[model samples]
Target: MPKDQLLRLQALEAAERRMKIWTIPLQTPNNRGAFLRRFIERVSDRNLHTAVPAQNQSAVQKAAQFYQSCSLVYTTGGERELSTVRRLLADFGVFWPRLSNASNLLRICFAMSAVLDWAPVILFSLARPGHIVVTPAPFYAFLLGRRRAMLSSSNDGREYKSYFSHMVDTFRRQEPSSDVLSYYELLAMESQIVPALQQAYTAADGGIIKNGTLDDILNLAGEAIPRSKWDDELGKNFKSAIPNDTTALRFVIENVFFFAEFFALMDNLSESQLAYYVGWTAVQGLSLFTKPAVINFYYPSRSQALQGHVMACGALSHHYMGLAFYANYIREEFSAHELADVIALVNHVRKFFREGFSSSGALKEFIDKSQQSLDQNAPFPSAASAPLSFVTDSQEGQLNELFRHFPDQKPSIFDNIQSVAVARRMTRADTRAANFRWNGKVRLYYLTDDKRFELLPTALEPPFYSAEAPPAVKYGALGAEIGDAMAALVSMWLRDADENTRAKVYTEALCRHNRPVIPVETATTQVPSWPNISRRELAERVVSLNAAFRAFLDATDGGNQYRLDGYESLTGKRMFFIIWCMAQCGASYGKQKCHDPLRLFRYFARAFECKVGSVMSTIRECT
Candidate 1:
């Protein structure tokens, strides 16, 4: 009787006429009326439903009345009738919960169901026969469902609307596709995923819904596509008639091989695998907090400053996962078969990283170079033989190009700090210092300063020094010792938390670097002829001056901002930036040849909480 309910019904009717999507009889009679009358008399609020007159009617009319009334109910409280009412309403083609209240996952299921239901028509309309949708969830879902007959279908052998219907009917019914992540499963996993992965499983198992099964489901999802099925076929697609140097053919085969093997390795039962997966997932999730995904900013323009930060976090996650795989391979004692697979994956990633460091626009350069590199017959490089390949000239060039864009006037640390700064949340200076370690020019910002944490001179110049230079030598010795201490602290903290804890402990620890450290030599500088700038006075000036000259030092220090902005807002963007910066710093400092590997590893690992290891949750900080 009310204008809105009538309009909704009219709209559904009109949609049926134009789209011919579905139809439902518009009436129901007395048995439903008794249920409705009984339900309505109990409601204290009269305006809850459109004014459906309580009267004697046909079964279809009464059913329609009941459906409309049930649809209007927002949520199920303690009422026992609500379940029965919802089931009946669903049968009448009112499947959605209230439009505003529907979860995002539900919307996805609905849309996917529509697509699956209409797949035959869709296929006919398309000119291309092999087109695939690129959305992460839908693609994953389609693969998940079709790979296994998880749900019955009607639209051709491929349609899947019924699954969606089942998914939404209740929460527990939304299970992982015996093949991709389902909404219900994602929700279940997310609710229980602690930093401590094992504990998370225990917690989930203890709950009404089963937990800790995400890994099993995720692992099983990949198993649906077996290596035997795709191996020879993928190889034959790229085999050239050429004998020795078929670079193009080799690249394709190798990548396909790498992806498949790596996918399997990701499912391994090794301790490293557990740590790596949990940490990687944590990094991905943490990105949401620092970036917020709300603001619309261009990547190289307004958002350039944040780009490295984001990439740093993302890359670190990848790097750690890669390391975990490496460590697991090492732990297993490197048999020939395992080594072959490990080498292939390492080459794939190294190939990817090398392409980045190669040229002006590395991404563009990579697309062209990769095609060429893949054709070659040479075996892909390993950690031992492929140092040049992994951290290649091209990636270095790209990093330099990226770092050059940060304005070169002086050594200021916070040029783009404003993007992350929120009210009362000025970026703690330590964030900038932490971020600098990841900017790829570690020696420039750190080496010349004696690792003393003092602010840089307002007048620093370019091409500070090579790793082979005298200053770097000094840094290698002393910085290594300090770095060791840092790592020990991080390893212990990470091991102790439940699997679900955010890696925030690492973030908080790195902030300590913001407070400048005093060298023992400077403890008693007594310059009687000159006013002594107390160490505290010196540190304050360093922080303030870095903030002051952020725009000028873009070249010497790369485009990193030394100023204290965006520290408070702590958006996902900043989190990504900070975490990434830390990763770069770790990789740079932790490189095998640079300093004492054990010491350097412990130092940055502590700072980063060794978030990259496999099941070795905590690598001791070299204290």
Candidate 2:
């Protein structure tokens, strides 16, 4: 074993005794397969263990008749276990050519099994109460590490030690990664679990391990408890309570079952071939343990040196990286005058936002008197409505406060994880210090509930931002972004009203400014819903939104004062409108759904000289 893995196990063993908290058995490599035998090993999947239900039996049996001649296994394969395996695959309509490697065939069977069984497995995992470890294969190495820790119990220690040792030995024969993220990029997921699970599930007075809080389970796994996970409603909105009874909760897991459905495709493989599937999964999961040169073949140029340009940018962007990256960005792009102008510009935007365009009565959102700007130097991150109700309102002081306990270790997988864990803990502890976004906190980064915004210093750079650029260029990009944010603020300010009223507030606020209503739509094409409003309301809503900004644009020419003629051929009004239109130009198409609504903005109608009832021009009012 490498020194690092060796030491890691040794350290875990040593540390387990010093802590007064509970511990699990020493995890050793040798015991991998034993737990599989111990687990009730049943999965919720219907296809894997249950016969085809009557409803589906007709179709399955019908399909089974056509492929009967293929034979389950070839005459040439080994006889020791071939008969039993062949019969199993044949029932599922998984016939093999008489000529193939055992493991490959088993893998095909595993995949078929998985397709039939994914739902029950996912359900079992989501709702189950005991030993809910998610993985493709058994985690015997973890068991070995657990056994080495040797948690004390007056009666169980000796038995646990023996069991743990045996499990470790079995695991060494074939082991799996603790967990893996199959997310396009392969990242070996490391967890500090088990103890948390034991605490949550096991009875303190020594009863059966039956239940625990959902929050505790997620926390132990270093994951946040999203509101939807416990949802009893339409799986989106969060429920405040968890029900312990049968009506509220569904599946129960008394033992570990391979969520074999995901792997059922591998069933065509021979027993040895099946090991290769697990072996490859382990390889992907443990690739980090392999040399970086080998790992980089799969993922090139992803991770970087701890203090390089990429990391510096990442550190600046991530809450864990704190103000260091911001400082680095400032140093690179900011001059003394540039810094001052940026600050002035920030306060300038804030002042304009706080005090209204025409009159300050526009936005009445309950937020801080002043918000601090920490120039997200890169492609910026979003902000919450409450806006860092946590950070101090200063760029310099907030940076210092942001990184107070940020661990000062060289970049390594272990240190990075530890740093994040500490930073997350700090979010709950020193929240009064400075606002940190990336900690394991709420569901999203930028929320639209309250009044809040952050500064994106990168927006001030070229070709997006340049101090020397013409007003058309600047406003066309960054200025338009500011305008968009203003629009978002208008939308957010109305959020306090009841949902319907909120929609009315946006439309009314837009039309109330009386810049130029797009005139309500006459005929309708397919426009996507805007949260609560109907299609007609959304058109009026967009026009109304532009009305307030129209007033802002009308008040200025080339950003100096509004003029009918902008620069040369384009008028100031035209430039402001064009820049605003161009700034909001991206959308996504997915699942036969397209959500690009920017074309509906009246600017396009006016630009194209549409009279009315055209694609860009609407005749319907929001009311």
Q: What's the TM-score of every candidate structure?
A: 0.18, 0.40
Model 2 CA deviation exceeding 4 Å by range: 1-292, 299-319, 339-407, 411-416, 419-450, 490-493, 509-578, 585-604, 620-623
RMSD of each: 29.0, 24.6
lDDT of each: 0.25, 0.32
lDDT tens digits by residue: candidate 2, 174-225: 3344332231111111112223223222221222124534443333323221
lDDT: worst 10-residue window of model 1: 118-127
lDDT of 1 by residue, 1-623 (tens): 89999999997665445322100111222122233223223221221232334553222222223333322222222233334333423322232322212122212222222222111000101001111111111112122223234333433323233333333343122443332334444334333322222222212112121121323223423863344433332233212221232222211111122223323443543323222222223222222113212111112133532332333322222111112111211223334443344344334332332332233232223223333333333445543342112122113343233223222211111111111112102211111122112111222122211111111110011111112212211122222222221222223233445543313333222223233333223223332221123222222222222221221122224323222232334332222223222222323222222212221123333333334231111222212
Sequence-dependent TM-score of model 1: 0.18
Clashes of each: 72, 78
